[model samples]
Target: MLKPRMIEEKMLILLRQGKISKWFSGIGQEAISVGVTKAMQEDEYILPMHRNLGVFTSRNIPLYRLFSQWQGKASGFTKGRDRSFHFGTQEYKIVGMISHLGPQLGVADGIALAHKLKNEKKLSAVFTGEGGTSEGDFHEALNIAAVWDLPVLFCIENNGYGLSTPTIEQYRCKDLADRGPGYGIESHIIDGNNIIEVFEKISELAQSIRNEPRPILIEFKTFRMRGHEEASGTKYVPEELMEEWGDKDPIINFENYLLQEGILNEEKIKGFRKSIKKEIDENLHKAFSENIIESDTSQEIADVYETYDHQEIISKSNKENIRFVDAISQALKQSLERHYDLVFMGQDIADYGGVFKITEGFMGEFGKDRVRNTPICESAVVGTAMGLSIKGMKAMVEMQFSDFVSSGFNPIVNYLAKVKYRWDQKADVVIRMPCGGGVGAGPFHSQTNEAWFTKVPGLKVIYPAFPYDAKGLLNTAFNDPNPVLFFEHKALYRSVRQDVPVDYYTLPFGKSSRIKEGEQISIITYGAGVHWALDTLEEMNFAGADLLDLRSLQPLDLEGICASVNKTGKAIILTEDSLAGSFASEIAALISEHCFESLDAPVLRVGSLETPIPFAQTLEREYLPKERFKNKLQELIEY
Candidate 1:
């Protein structure tokens, strides 16, 4: 406890001297970090909040590397990508918190879920503050943890204030632990200032949880001795409250108790302080002298996705006619059989199958442990998939509809997408998104939201048009080390059928297939739009056109798109998304920029109307781009 306290004290001086950018002081709250961390087993994972600098120090992370992280040096854990305890280290079994306080709670549930599935007696511990209890993630995480009976120690540090807001304004309950009983979790409240009490209580709870594998909540009632950060001073706190808490400082009180017991004396304490100070000074000097990170586009791009050796999948002669949905189901079944560590999770996916019956009969084939059903908590389920991926298990999540992705957006875009670049952690998770319209399922159930994920870095976006492409791309998605968003068009689930290979195969991302070769114009599209373009071209008796299907959006077929445009010298990009900010616009922009000199006219784009998808069949038909695509292609051909 004193070691982290002394290191933080020196860090505070560095903050004052402008040697570091900022600091979130854990001055009076060191007991919670030190005690809780000490109580856990070394192999157990702990997700610490930003103020829990003591957790990092307690785990024996090198002072030079930590200081280097804070100083934004190249040798830091994040390679100068983030600051504070915002980065996680796989080596120390520490998953650090993001700026959003409550999300890590769900991640902790994920790690615990993995342990339980593997029949390991390991438990995970996660920390959050009193204010974080108000977040929806807090409720979702606790509910799922309780429902699944996962082994997780949820620690809440009730440090009197959330930034400047008092505890009175934060909640109506007497203590945060009071809400634990509502979730069917065992709850306890402890004196966070008393190091011995915190340690003993946490140790008992951890042991019980490990033995039985159930969720536990511990509320540590303590006070912050400094401002939220150095810049945000505690001026809003009453002077009387500050003075009262000042008298109860954990470090000073512990030192006095040790002295009274004759375990520590003035001379021995002085010597300990001298040695710690010397060590911190030398580390700070080394960290300060380290080279700063430089901007390298190639290196930055390389770090965005992990590299893997491509295995050429030989096409077998065995083929059978299958629907698009069947191809997806076959790919998932094959993946589950091949990878023993893969887990498939979604609402009603186990026994009831799924809303679309995509996973029908999966539970009987794979068992409940592998084909698991989840609550209606999208955020927690996504975070759990990420946690499973972090533990070397592959995870597949099914979004009933792409619209509900908004609820799980933070984990996918913030955590799963950024984990690799931030901490070199690969999240091998695939989120199956059933998107697009034509079945009159209304706005919420039908949407082509592929553009939302294509703009996000460190994510693979696959939108296949036919059954063959769907199965092949899915195989590649399951094998990739990065997070992938597999978009399956709802209308094409059963409407599209083709003779797909029964044997396993994989297709490379960023590669496009040319459906037909022509010279008059180039038609670029994907997903359902591919079928629309094919029908339109055949209906109009237009044979002089180059038709290209972009199977993946993020690792897009830029070279193929440019090549087609250069050959035809005229292009029309089509999509099911809205015209404004649609992916079609991006393709058009790329064509104009890369193949401008070879163009015969201005590039064209076709997309849905800029309005929410309506429930009425007529309204949806008028909104989609299928009718408008013919005119756009004609306009491009004439030009």
Candidate 2:
């Protein structure tokens, strides 16, 4: 009864004191949180949403740390880079908490799947608000969880509003819990205001879900007495909402139950409130007055981000490396052979071998138990990877097309990206994405958006054009301590295949490969589009178009790029992604800043024009930097 009020009071205090910049409230929504947490085992895993402050506190996220995070203190989780609402403690087995509405469901599924595969007893519980239940990701997560029968408990806190949109407007269904049974999951609706009822119901549901190896959904019928956060207001809320829900306030209702059940006397209850208020006030002050950390933390953070460097030749057959896809296929083959803790998942990745056929023969090599095929739910695929990655397994997921990468954006950024850095945990995860624009594949299928991932710190972005590079990069990603998104150019999958080295070796990330060097112009690029830039140089009769393959995009070889620019005196940056704020933009800026005086023609940029890439095959080439390439030789000769 006191958990929600105390936390809300603390949040309000911190907000007014300017100690907490952001805080989500579960004031009237407490019983459900406290109930589920009470039902969950001390060591079982949980992925919480922002509103479940009571659950988090029970899970051992100290109020001060949470408060300090909200206050934007340096000591906060995410090194103060993340939001106050994002609270997690790996030591306590709270996998993570994300601000994204329903994505955690997928994350939980992944972990449960991994745990079950490894024969571990741990289960995963994910919490989300009523509003978040309607997303495609929500349905995706539930479907996978049911199919796998992963021991996961999904608790929905139906506070009636998905922000300002009411439940009636959000879904046509009468009960969110009812939808779970359709997915072969057991479910129940609980009176969230009644702590005893909630606790018992949650325990029963959690046991069933965990024991059956299937999921169970608990629709927590609660009300929000406070606003969404300390930042937002209740102005949009109707008067009748406040009036009708007043009787359903968990705190007030729970307190009455405690009194009726003789669990607490009036005087003792009053004393408890007073004590909680004082504790909250003191905690807020402490959270504010705590010491700060400086910027050198990332160096140590980077230092700690090391895994056991495990690179070994599994078989001559495994790695007399062949095609780019061969490296992927062999890597999966070797990964499956070497470690039973590995799982391969994605759309068409099982038997059909993915849309690019990258996972060909995987179903035969590793049976359904290990190499699982998924529905076309990229968000679910990645989210499940997050879960498995948490449970001490290496999960290699395939995103059918790089363009569809946006579907699982939340898990990639919030769950997969931040898990290790934020909670001091590990996510040995890799996402294989077929990327780049070329071969007249049209706009939807062809787009290189690695730049969207490049700016994201902690994630390693690998783009390999040849079979050898693919083999090396896959090794690097598998060995990497953090999450890695390995971008395989679909055009290059069958288009190019160099006989790779027999030895198990890895090309270090952030290094550039110079295919050829020339003095006239340095054609700096990555992926399949770079091939065109190279071809253009020859077609235009430029004797010197220095082609440097940017194999690693995130840890860009600035020194290499600088050296090339200094030698060539002219440069042209080409990329197939959108023109604005693209990788080309970054490279151009880097050259201008470092090798500015050496520039001959304002550093020519050959990239897709600043517009949505059109669908027509002929128009696609036209949209790219043809003039920069067409006039390359002429421009160089003039220079």
Counting clashing residue pairs in each candidate, in order, gives 0, 8
lDDT of 2 by residue, 1-639 (tens): 485567777567657877556667777777777888888898888777777777777776666776677665765676665675565666777755666667778888887887688676667889888888878888999999887788888888888776667787988888889898888887888888888898887787767666667777788887776667655678778889888888777777777877999998999988988887777777767886887656676564673344445454442433353767776666556556766777888777777877766667878867887888887788888888877776777788877888888987777877676676665667778888887665677767777778888877667788877777777778777777678889988777777767776656666788899988787778888887567766776676666867899988877899999999999888878777767888888899899999998777778666667776666877876776655556654665586
lDDT of each: 0.90, 0.76
Q: Indicate the worst ten consecutive residues by lDDT in candidate 1.
A: 308-317
- Model 1, stretches more than 4 Å misplaced? 315-317
Any runs in candidate 2 off by more than 4 Å, and if so which?
Answer: 17-19, 230-244, 251-263, 266-285, 292-321, 418-427, 533-545, 608-630
Among all candidates shown, the one with the greatest lDDT:
1
Per-candidate TM-scores read: 0.98, 0.89
Which candidate tops TM-score?
1
Candidate 2, residue 388: CA error in Å?
2.2
**Which residue pairs overlap in candidate 1's backbone?**
none
